[model samples]
Target: MGATVVQLTESKKQIQHTHRTFDDQTKAFRSNPMPSISERRENLKRLKRLILTNQERLIEAIDRDFSCRSKDETLIAEVMPSIQCINYTLKHLDGWMKPSKRHVSMLFQPASNQVHYQPKGVVGIIVPWNYPLYLAVGPLVASLSAGNRSMIKMSEYTPHTSALFKEIIEGSFPGDLVSVITGEADVAADFSAQPFDHLLFTGSTSVGRLVMKAAAENLTPVTLELGGKSPAIVSPDVPMEDAAQRIAFGKAFNAGQTCVAPDYVLCPSDRVQAFVDEFRTRFSEMYPSIRDNDDYTAIINERQYARLQSYLDDARAKGAKIIEINPARENLGDGTRKIPLTLILNTTPDMKVMQDEIFGPLLPVVGYTNLDEAVHYINERPRPLALYFFGYDRGQQQYVVHQTHSGGMCINDALMHVAQDDLPFGGIGDSGMGHYHGKEGFLTFSHHRAIFTKQKFNSGQFVYPPHGTSLHKMIYKLFIR
Candidate 1:
């Protein structure tokens, strides 16, 4: 009973702290509502320096959190991309901040119209466990670039990394300008409920719905970066090795915990077996051993491991062909929580693996007779975060691009589009909404305030209050036609 009381008290304290931090940040934002571009650029530069100086420590923390996160994978997927995003934003911040000159209709001549990009005060960023560093820093870069004060809520699942990140950030920036909140699921719920200028969440679709509902209470605009069953379609004419190799890398990188990872493969009916064979070959080449291999990342935690294992069990029971590409054939049943790149063939829509977003090293192969069938199959379900089509045919590529809907796509490649700093990354429907990256990122966190300057003359006065006046009629007659 005493322990329970203590627990409740601690929970309440954390909730209060989250609220206080948010309030402080809000106050700070109001004081310095519009930070100069130089200030914003300095913030990004400091962030980059922090990441670079503590790169090894951050990697180690994530490794400890995951039990065995690949250092190379963390560097490539998290650190490198974060620095690159900051660099890209710094290079383009000036251009993005410039007021856009807009055309004024002749009806309102002698007036100048422009759109000023103003920061949306304080932004709330909720980072997911997978790729914690990059996910947190990527949105931070966008938020800082837009000159908004920010408060980040790091995932509890990644405690070590989250704690270290909070420490690092707190040491560099004032708490009111940039605060980091850390705690369990309840704390996250409380964090989401806080009133923010804009909230950006990166996580599963189910959790995203709750976040949106919470944000709605405050009428806070939200940018949800949710994950779905992003698919990879292999064309009949494409080389099996090429398609399989690329798909394998996408599905195997970070052990396929990526939000934009290729969840399933749509292959030509006749080439399914060949594609699987090549994928197995490519995966084996990538990591010949899984049990003791540092390059091979393990599932984040035992809970996630069990969830993924249950997926395989359900698929196997449903008469799906399970192919385990354990090249070394080592028994990974140990506590390493490492599962080799497993492929599920003969999948039915009724199976859990097919229904849910497989956010692990499990890839399901669905055979399609033609491109139309493949496109139709994708359209029937919720729009995915990403889509990969591998083929050299320009007409077929155009057809795929025109017909399908996804947050992003890659032609003749898989997962590489996300690495591009210029493209705007986001989803369409159930996958997600609102983009944040490059120019779009800056715009997402900014309010495009339309300004019209009229000195010594008000053109709108010509049509004001009095009806059917000679001047008003003349003006209407001249412009209406």
Candidate 2:
């Protein structure tokens, strides 16, 4: 019990230290509230240079955390997007900073109106484990571009990457300018409880609720980037081979750990077998061997691996047809963390695989009789982070767009919409809320201040303070109509 008391005291000290650091950063923001455009650009350049110079080290650290994260996957999914976001912000930030003039009515002819974008103070970003680098840096790019200081809370799950990021940030910028915090769930809870100008969280919906609840204590505005069961629909007009390969790429990338990864596929009832065959073939071509394949990514840890295995077991016990796609026919249970990509057919709504967001490489293929059925099936559930439609028919695409609601949508492609610098990325309903990307991101972290100016001319003195004069009658007649 004495040892426990010592441990408790140490933990209390750690929490107090973190709180003090947050207060110091808040005070720093007060010291220099607004930074000039040149200063903001310089900060962004420093960040880009740091990442580019240490690209190899960051990749290795992430790989070590995940046990076997593909280096190419990190480059494509994390590094490339982060660098592109920085460059995109640099190219358009000047225009984004400029205020827009508004038209003033003739009645108020002497006055002019304009909306200026100003930075909110300090922002808090909560990073998730799956895509640690991109999720952390993505929001930082937006926060800095808007000229706001920020503090990032890295996930405890990815310790190697989190520790490395903290060190890199310390070396790159002052703690008050930008800081990184690393700790377990208790630390995260304390971090979220602190009052920030704005808070951005990217993780599961269940956890998002908890973060939001904590943020509510301070009435802090929040931007939630949560995940749900995103679906991929294959139109009857599209060929099975084309649809299957694209969908396979979306599901197989990151071993299906991405927030916007395709959770399931909706195939026409008559073409289910053909689609399945094509998907298996495409997955094999991409990864010939699962056990020893460098291209194939392993699940992050034993807990998640076991959870996915349990999902499969629960589905199989419910009489669903489970097809494991092991092209090399390797032993999956011999102490390897990598699980062969498996496809579950004949899934029911009652099955666990159909109920939860399948974050693993398991795909549940649902056969729908028509497009309306697929759309209805999706609409019946909570809105997803992304929805994919594979077809060239413009009418059908528009119909799907009008009929369904999601955070974002991709036509004839998968997972590419999030990469577009011009589009806003976010989720709706249970998936999440608020957008952060491109101009929307700038606006998300900015306060659009409305200003009005009037000339020294005195036109309103004619009707000043009189009960009902001829001028007042005339003015009322002219303007009130």
Each candidate's clash count: 0, 0
Please state the error at residue 92 of candidate 2 in Å: 1.1
The window of 10 residues in a row where model 2 has the poorest summed lDDT is: 6-15
TM-scores of all candidate predictions against the true structure = 0.98, 0.96
Top candidate (lDDT): 1
lDDT of 2: 0.92
Tens-digit lDDT track for model 1 on 306-363?
A: 9999999999999999999999999999899999999999999999999999999999
What clash pairs does model 1 have? none
lDDT of 2 by residue, 1-481 (tens): 9987775676576567677777887888788887899999999999999999989999999999898999999999999999999999999999999999999887777788999998899899999999999999999999999989889989988999999999998898998889888777777888899898999999999999999999999999999999999999999989878898899899999999999999999989899999889999998999989887878898998999999999999999999999999999998787668888889999998998999998989999999999999999999999999999999899999999999999999998899999999999999999999999888999999988999888898665766895598888988899898
Worst 10 residues of 1 by lDDT: 457-466
Residue 196 in model 2: lDDT: 89
CA lDDT of every candidate: 0.93, 0.92
